[model samples]
Target: MAPVRIAVVGLGKIARDQHLPAIAANPAFTLVATVSREGDGVPGVPHFQSLDQLLERGPAIDAAALCTPPQVRHELAAMALARGTHLFLEKPPGATLAEVAALQGMAQASGATLFASWHSRFAAGVAPARSWLAGRRIDRVQITWREDVRVWHPGQAWIWEPGGLGVFDPGINALSIATHILPQRFFLKSAVLEFPANRAAPIAADMHFCDTHGAPIHMDLDWRQTGPQTWDIVVETDAGRLTLSNGGAVLALPDRTERDEDREYAGLYAHFAALIRSGQCDVDVTPLQLVADAFLCGRRREVEAFED
Candidate 1:
């Protein structure tokens, strides 16, 4: 295989720390260009200010990996798909489910492979957990995904804006894992979104969910925790108690420990490569649908202004 020639757009923190490094490490991809407004072009690669400019001047590329915010992802994906370029979208697909659905239709029409990259679902432990939980009755599920925004996101301004996803930004990762491991379709029962007085989006959320069988599930998300970041999910089932922590990178079961280091982005790229090679488009919007459902049905409550 002539390593898929690729370009990366939105050279932000994730593109720099995760996407770039993963592309460098994977032999299946070759970084050929970049599109960014401010980022210094990746070494030895052509950099364009926009996708239009890149398509007009950059080298022939096989695909484009978009690491931009969800607010603009739909437009970006449409642009790439219109050009018959396979698209790799970073999590949350789009700000709204409707946008992602539209992109899916566009991809089908253009005959381009569209991949909604959910890095968390590729975590080392996720497959194991999914295998064990198969055909088992889930009694309950609890998710605690709390982290300090100051420590993790630093001073990103967009995170507090509408469509920036705020707490749901990280919480979606948990939902991706849940939707993958549990076979049943879960629906949002109720939710309380706690928004900071000064921001347009919520800083925290409490969501209650249940499956078709009425098995209860709850998730508590907070962006105010100042110490020892926590991202954990525990599930109780008739087979055994399984726990996945560190954002689905580790698994603990009653029989034995199944632990492995996470190279989530690398796994994601590998999967994307496979999808492209197989001429298949993988666009699972269930996780994003859950987020949309939360937004649609959630009751908003005002909280104290959050500050670093």
Candidate 2:
């Protein structure tokens, strides 16, 4: 079978760091072209500055991975589906749940695959954690995600913008993994978003969540930690305590013995390849829904100003 001819839209930080390298290493995909504002050059692939230009030169491309911001991805996804190309959307599929639902409909109508990928769900220890947690009764959960924006984001200014998602950017990965490994789905019960006084989005958020059964889940997201960054999730269950740290890179039991995993992007590409081969679409919007709900129902509080 011919490899899935793929194009990547929004050649930004993610596309450069994770998607490009993964595609290059995977035998199931061929990186054909890219769409970005720069429109400069990328090795052997044709590059277009806009999605329209790339779509005009489409058809040879079997699918397009949208690495754009959540706010603008909906329109690009719709266009890709309308043109009969499959889509792979980066995390937090869209800025709104309605948009993702609409894209699902478009994909169905066109008989195309729409893969809303949450890379963290594919972490090496996730499957094991899920299996271990299934038979146990989860009592409570806590997540702490703090990072330095300067070191991680550099000059990326959109992250602090209204649609850019700020600290929830990394925070949502925790939500995704929780949604996958936990036995029940959850809804946000209450949330406090800390927006920099001068910015449109929250720089930090403390959220309270509960499942239909009332199991408690608490999340703390911060972008101001200067040293010893932390990404950890602790779940207390009937069987034992399960903790995944390092942004899902490491898993530990109560005794603290650790197990490591491959990078998440690699697993994500593997899942995409399997989906394409099986003629199926994998679309999950639970994580994105939590984000939209946070925006709709969250109490916004003004905090310190953020620079860049």
Task: Give per-model TM-scores.
Answer: 0.98, 0.95
Q: What is the lDDT of candidate 2?
A: 0.86
- Would you list the C-alpha lDDT of every candidate in the order shown? 0.91, 0.86
RMSD in order of candidates: 1.0, 1.6
- The sequence of per-residue lDDT tens digits that candidate 2 reaches over residues 1-308 is 88999999998888898999999999999999888887574876888888898777654788999998887888899988998898899987887778888998998899888899999887777877888788688899998999988888888777777778888888889889999989988899999999888888888999999987788999999989998999888999887899988877778876655666576888888888888777788888888778878888999899878786
After TM-score superposition, the amount by which residue 76's alpha carbon in candidate 2 deviates from its true location, in angstroms, is: 1.2
Candidate number achieving the greatest TM-score relative to the actual structure: 1
State candidate 2's TM-score: 0.95
Residue 146, model 1: Cα distance from true site in angstroms: 0.5
Clash pairs of candidate 1?
Answer: none
User: Worst lDDT window (10 residues) for model 2?
Assistant: 254-263
